[model samples]
Target: MIKPYFLTALSGLFLTQACIADVNLESVTLDNNPRVLKSIALLQSLKSPQTAMQFNAPYVHDLKNRYKVRSLFVESQNLPIVDIQLTFNAGSARDEEVATGLHGIANMAAQLMDEGTEKYTANEIARAFERVGAQLSVKAYRDMFIVKLRVLSHPKKLEPALGMLMEILNHATFKKSSINLILSNTQVGQKQIQENPSRMMNVQFYRALYGKHPYAEPISGTQRSISKITPLQLKQFSNQFLVAQNMNIAITGQLSAKEALKLSERIAGNLKQGEKAQALPEPIDKSSFDIRHIASDSSQAHVMMGHLGTSRFDSDRLALEIANQMFGGSGFNSILMQELRVKRGYTYGAYSTFSFSQVPGTFSFSYSTRQDQLLSSVQVAHQALIDFVTQPIDLNQLAETKAGMLRAFPNNYSSNANINAQLGAMGFYHQAADYLSQYPKLLEKINAQDVQNAIQKHLHPERLTLIVVNDQLDKTALETRLKQDLNPQAAQPLPTENLPNILNPPEKEVIDLPVSFPTDAPEAI
Candidate 1:
């Protein structure tokens, strides 16, 4: 016979097992199913915030000094640091003005500016800034070349940093060794660019679109152009472009209005007042479709397509901005992403963008997909654009797009550094002094009709520039699909003979370079 304690233990174990076995799993699921579906429906009906965000525009003091130096200053007492940017009209677009085939002079000048001044060596200047915990940088872009300084607000730090910047601005040596070093590095870069499928396609795209226009060349320039740049030529380019009258000042961080004004005056007084750069010629819009295919070894095809777009000052800019946000520029929710990624699963992402600059820029859409899916992806993406332009404007979606923009507008000037950038851009592009404050109101004024009209005016689906990078392309098949996409109403397939000849890009040598300098410098605006 078992002991009484052992019998009690066995009985308790049996009871526990019986209770667990009696639980009806199906009944539990049946009871919770209604609640789970209801919760999902409730979540699906939830809407984005209806109220627009209020943005308190910072006080911008716009003033010009006797030396003709324009300035936009914003006082922020949040941090002990001060940030200053000098935006000059001199950029890569003006390279040809220095001399024909000298496409990289402006870029070379920027890279060498901090290498040395007449009074200081490059290492000495670097040590001086490091000792004061200050930072100095110079960069070049398509429309502007900028020099920036960040230092403590105290006069001890600010004064020394300012002095060094002034010296460099007035008397950058552009020494022979420095010039040779930059050119040597650029030569290595040329080989790498040729190896890059995307970069090669961009070079070809600009060449095809702008044809002999100043904007046709990439800012990095070709090897032939950069190798010809000399130290004397760089100095001449600097003397002509980097002067007081050709640039504007932007100051932000801890400072009073009076102090800021004085600082601006001192900077302006140190440089010679050269004339401002003239306007860039407008890019000619093409009437026919231009398509090219580049050979690549990658398994995925990199594709880009677009036509000439609007300028920064276009009357329909706000409308186009909203439309682009809805159609492609914004991620995931954009029509292109929805069609290509969510609906078809042909690509990881599909994006479209507009480059609003001093002159008209490209309105482009680009993506990469498996090589086998290239033709279908191109056709589908093109069809989406066509539908967006030809179909009736979806007022509800437009409202959502504008709401998203208004809600996200605060990030544009959320920090002192960001505000400084905005001020610099406004001053460089000649935007109205009150442009930031009036952004929301102007954006709200746009309606569905405005967006529709702007899209039709700016986007020409019939005349597009198509670029594809893959191992090979079926030219005859792609032409047939493009003809159908361009003329859906046509009873017959359009002739493919008129399509521009495909481009065969030559292979380039690959070279790898190690990074030795700091990578934290600010990018050119």
Candidate 2:
């Protein structure tokens, strides 16, 4: 490392330069001429933000069934490496209420596909990917199970990689030993995640708000479901729910349109087609109008509060998109972050987001503050939501939000992974395949009045189901505060069952208890 003196001297030089460049009153007065003002404006115009442009390359979607096969393909070969992705909608949503995390189960099940297949062992698959610098990844999200394979420039190598990946995606033994070990490891992970109050708060919050909307389930899934996810059940779920209609495949990077179409045919074709999927039920259990406080042993509180909002298909989706950015989704400029973190120093950082599912999604505000500041921060966030819905969004602020949304799209879809993710999202929501293409225009159409209208139509802060995970908080005081801010009738004490038994023991049984192992340690008996 450079010596401290050298670093200090370099800093001093920069500081001196900054000081010399500082403005004086006389300099400001002298520079306030019409020509100077005009020049400043001209420079500002020259430095204008680049408008986010659309990919002019026409998106080609062609599904083929050649030689007794069926597969869907969208060909856009922009790079040398051709990507093949196969997806199925056999996510956790397909799990029973008891099997809450089936989506996670499906995902974990897929990972074992390459562990050892009927024809190939784990070592062989690893060596293949290693030899060719290819990669295969499997993941289960809220709505789908995804299998992605990437291979080199050679079509011959790419075809073999795709074949190997397809075998994994389509037929996995999900060996019993692997399943048991995965479940055991998952329990360990579950304990760690639940230990974090934020994760705990979000999980319980979703369950409370959505009640039974598949949206209520955890993304990865729960331990109970994972444990009971027998290999046979895995096969059934894959066969039933993971069908063609529920699947979407997206390709980007390295390949020609004709080759892409051919590749898609070779991979997904002849995978028995299923019926068109219908829309999922909305989180319309709007009756869950409650405020829940989950006490944990922590210094700062983890808070997440919001209610059901719009779906991707809603006309005001674009408006809500802009609304979310203005609220807390846009980093520093948002009111929640500005007030809760920047102004009050209550949190390190704060942000609010409204997640849209196929159905009415949740509009949530989440943040953490010191134990003492918990209730106060929650109240401020609540009030901000209320204000956002009731008041008219300012035109300048509205423009900024829309501009940010518009400007961020290209970056969002910059990678093949990103493009596929967005496509998957849009496809899951039954959105127009052209939604991305029409995004800039759709967002441009949103006006100031539309934002305010959307807020009123979708946001119901008063009806929010608040979740605050704070340790040793004054429960009575919080209830009182909530009553004063929201409706008096809505205020209710902590429900006995709302608290998840994450710690696996009652507070009374463990608190301040002395450790007494038998004087001589207990025997194996």
Return the number of clashes found in candidate 1. 0
Best by TM-score: 1
lDDT of 2 at 230: 79
lDDT score for candidate 1 against the true structure = 0.80
Cα lDDT tens digits for candidate 1, 234-330: 8999999999999999999899888898899999888888898898998999997788888889767888888888787788988988988888877
Ten residues in sequence with the least summed lDDT for candidate 2:
516-525
In angstroms, give how far residue 494 of model 2 lies from its true place: 24
Over 1-525, each residue of candidate 2 has an lDDT whose tens digit, in order, gives 899999999999999899757834234332456444434444444445574344542353434435322332344456667566666665555565225445466556665667866677788878878777799887665555677777776867776677677666566677788888888888888999778676677778778877767767676677876767777777666666655666766666666666666665655554546554455665664643477778787756677777776765688877887888898878889887766655655565677766554566667777766666677777667766766777667788888888777766676566665665555555444456566667778789888888888888888865778777766666577656655556535643321222222234333321211111111001100
Model 1 residue 418 CA deviation (Å) reads 0.6
| CA lDDT, candidate 1, residue 24 | 47
Relative to the true structure, how large is the alpha-carbon lDDT of every model? 0.80, 0.64
As a whole number from 0 to 100, the lDDT of residue 144 in candidate 1 is 82
Residues forming the 10-long window of minimal summed lDDT in candidate 1? 512-521
For model 2, the stretches where C-alpha displacement exceeds 4 angstroms are 1-78, 97-104, 274-279, 474-476, 486-525
